[model samples]
Target: MALPIPTTLDEITADWLTSALRQSEVISEKTTVLARTVEVLGVGEGFAAELARMHLSYKNGSGPATVIAKIPTSVEDNRNGSELLGVYERELRIYERILGEIEVSTPRLYYGDIEVNPDAASQLERIRKMERLPIWLLRLILWFLIRFNKGKTFPSVLIMEDLSPAEAGDQVQGCDLDRAGEALEAVALLHAATWGDRCPQERYWLVSSAVAPRLFHAGALGARRGFLKNFGRLLSDHTRELYESTRTDNIERTIRLHREVPQCMLHGDFRLDNMFFARDGGFRALIDWQLSSFGPAVSDIAYFICGSIDPGVSEAEIDALLARYHRALESAGVSDYPLEDLHAHYTEQLLLLLARMASVDLLDLGDQDGRGADLVSVWIERLDARMARASSGR
Candidate 1:
């Protein structure tokens, strides 16, 4: 099936939603849309797409509640995949049939369909005219487009329970050894519950085969190369050696490790932004399952540790977080694996991380304050040091 060309926000309207929801029987005339806000969160340079979030308030018979709407920029900005309605249709099927059954915390999906918002039409036109503008200028224009699109018509939009980022912000500030541990524990539980001997590998393989190629082709290699070039200067001599070693390894070893390693359901994107913290000081949910797949357990662990933890965090703190993760894994019935084996697995996976990390735009130093860069450097350095120590002993 061909990919659906994405629709613009201006293309979405309330009538479209009303009609779609009527088919689903979730909302009716008694249901009123209170407020609507459009937010362009980020843009994907790799896919040349944008990530947007829509905040909507709706009143059912009793009162009012909020919902979140996500519309990929490619659909809205590029109009590339509209022809393939099945893209989102299949995603909805996965969410309802497979992901919904899993233990992982995800936002409640209400309805998803394709339509256009009239309010967005004018702004999107203006944005299109300003195509030659600098990125910062374009971003400003998009932000304005979001503000202008608010309270206008909503077309077909993917709706889910609205989650606030405030609590998550608080969690980052309050981050300590314990909170880090809880997050890792959550990851372990998610992995353990989703995949095991009891689960059908065919189901996951179906999704993986469909998705992995796109990811690899869609700037995965380019991203890795970009990250290395931009940040290679930060790596110590030891870290550089490990980076060089991975280049010498053949694809056979990479593929063998991927196949032989214990497989588990993966939260393909486990970065901090995708996770939500509850008001009561625990994980509320994990969002953005678009990249969910089956892969090595260490993939998720390495991504989280290297991507989320602040660089300012001491090595001692990192060690503690690692311990907490192991404890969490043990509690989840994943105790058979040795710590040394787990670390080695994580080390071997670093090359993959190095490859993928560079392609995407990381949270700015303002957002992560060199934390992500620091973690990556530290991992490289530690691996290099360990390899050297081993060689000396040999």
Candidate 2:
């Protein structure tokens, strides 16, 4: 018998919770969840799902009070992208299947499923969904490129043990040096465990080898248009000039560099908001596995340090952070990857990350007031400073 992905909070029964947990050995076979109060968890950043924290009442004394459920997003516009990119599919698979084979701290999976469909959705998913194709020949060519797709549109839902006991690092305020160090440790362990782990690569549904590779390619086509739109508000005249001069060439080079680095397990979206810290100063879990991939070590490292640099992190200090990551990697038995090579990779990742972050056409920092706006400003501030320093040959 196949299980269905629960689409809403009301659908999750105490019996289902008991069955799932008992299977995972989180609870004894005799133990069971009796009731639960579902509190929808964090929002304002990740748009893929409505995260609900379930406060449970158990029949037995040993069971936990809370578990987290990731359901489909409330935002209609974002749903298409989430589904098309298989975001939920990736996260669910990681928890239910892949994470068990790796040594990383993530929410313990209670239940997960990518719903099955017998439809031929993937055959024409790309070309058939094309909007206003003027040329028949071009449309036909695209349709012909992708041969056969048995892929169905599946709703990937995941339920995991709640980590609400820990504090999620703030992406807006950014992590300080100490928190950043903890994040590097979390990332190093993730990479080290799966540096050459063949488990993920064997899965056919997990084809995206890097985080949002399609977006990177599409964004490249429209880079100038989007960057120019948000340029005036985010940059000084000098920094803007500097950004304009090297931006295109750098993105071109770095995208290539990003693809060419040694492949390993990556927590693709390793930002502050996605990380939780225990009160004892230990990193708890890395959430939002939508972007998990086999890519460069610096892919995750660069992504984390870039967003988590408090208010003012000097370039030298940023370089030192990369060094800290290298040391941790070596501690985890990763040998021969020198700090100098890591530094070069970090620089390229930072450049590519900045260009992509700033190059989105729809990022109106004004629409989102408060912390959202503040995070954008901080990102742009860091971007401007870095570009300016590079231009000055500092």
Candidate 3:
């Protein structure tokens, strides 16, 4: 029988590692985790989950000396938010189902499992049936439902290769041009590989459209409100107007238009923070699949360029990066997508990304001292600069 998925670091015992690694064939049956030490990692980096680096000792045989373990966040609000969006399930499904078939550089998965709350599923179903309810009442009910579902155990786990010594990109610091080019090329590889016929359709849940629009509609109200509350001071007159225009109706229209484009796998959260750079100054791995979904390929590129690049980065440099990404995609055999079309798609995607930025408030950011707030502020500032430049015809 399978061992229960570990929901907390303490629950991730040596026995659990032995069993999980064995089941995943990361270790021979003769090799058992004799002892292990777990060091909590990603203190302020990961919002939807908690990560730990586990150093291990084996008996009878050899195995990976170190690995990373990911479990659902203990932060009550964050965990509940993750459940509401099916974040944990989506990530587990990606690692278990999609990663193997793709060429994107991701951590080697050792084992992964998720036990979604049946009660949560039923509750969502009930809410879906109540679409006739007044919008205000439905939003209020969902707000309370999110609070009520707090601290519920929806255990999910992933044990995977540890890309140690590789530095995680800092969102607040932003990415330099060379590194940005590398990251863009990497994402282009993902988009090109998953383009058109290669897109996954068997798992409808992996598509962004699979989730009911009402959930996003409800969430956008709070997201916009929260974003305004936190970063309104940083907004310029032009930027503030743009932010305000991301009303639910506008956001829905943006989403509808994006859906009209040819779809590909998007590393939905493709920002510097979710990437790791090898010590040799090369791209190592992309982490955080919690937001993986199928969408307009440029959506990922637009999100990264608008949110992750240094705000001071020149328009010419940004264009160079985009052209680099386009060249990489062409090299990878995605011939039909023209550079001009990519730029147009990129512009539309940036607006959608602006609306999506508000969703950052959905996670629990209070515990990060001030880094969480600072990160969001920096992202908005960078994006605002880009939009301002675009509006000025520069």
Among the numbered candidates, top lDDT falls to 3
**Model 3 alpha-carbon drift over 4 Å, by segment:** 117-138, 150-152, 202-204, 209-214
TM-score of each: 0.67, 0.81, 0.91
The regions of model 1 sitting more than 4 angstroms off are: 1-6, 32-35, 39-64, 75-91, 114-157, 169-175, 203-229, 312-316, 361-394
lDDT of 3 by residue, 235-271 (tens): 7888777666666455465557556677788888888
Lowest summed lDDT window (length 10), candidate 3 = 202-211
On lDDT, the stronger of 1 and 3 is 3
Q: Residues 1-394, candidate 2: write the lDDT tens digits.
A: 4555566767777877777677667789788898878776665666567787888888864587788877777455455445555677667777777787877888877767777433324523443334234334432432233222223345656778778768888877777787788789878988877664432573433543433344343443344565567555767788666555554465355547645666687777888888889988888988888867676788787667656675367877777777778888889878857788887676666556655664344332335465545666676665665554445543
lDDT of 3 at 102: 81
Model 3 deviation from the true structure expressed as Cα RMSD, one decimal place: 2.6
Q: Rank the candidates by lDDT, best first.
A: 3, 2, 1
Number of the predicted model whose TM-score against the real structure is largest: 3
Candidates ranked, most accurate by TM-score first: 3, 2, 1
Native-to-model Cα distance after best TM-score fit, residue 299 in candidate 3, in Å: 1.3
Cα TM-score of candidate 2: 0.81
- Distance from true location, Cα of 186 in model 3, Å: 0.6
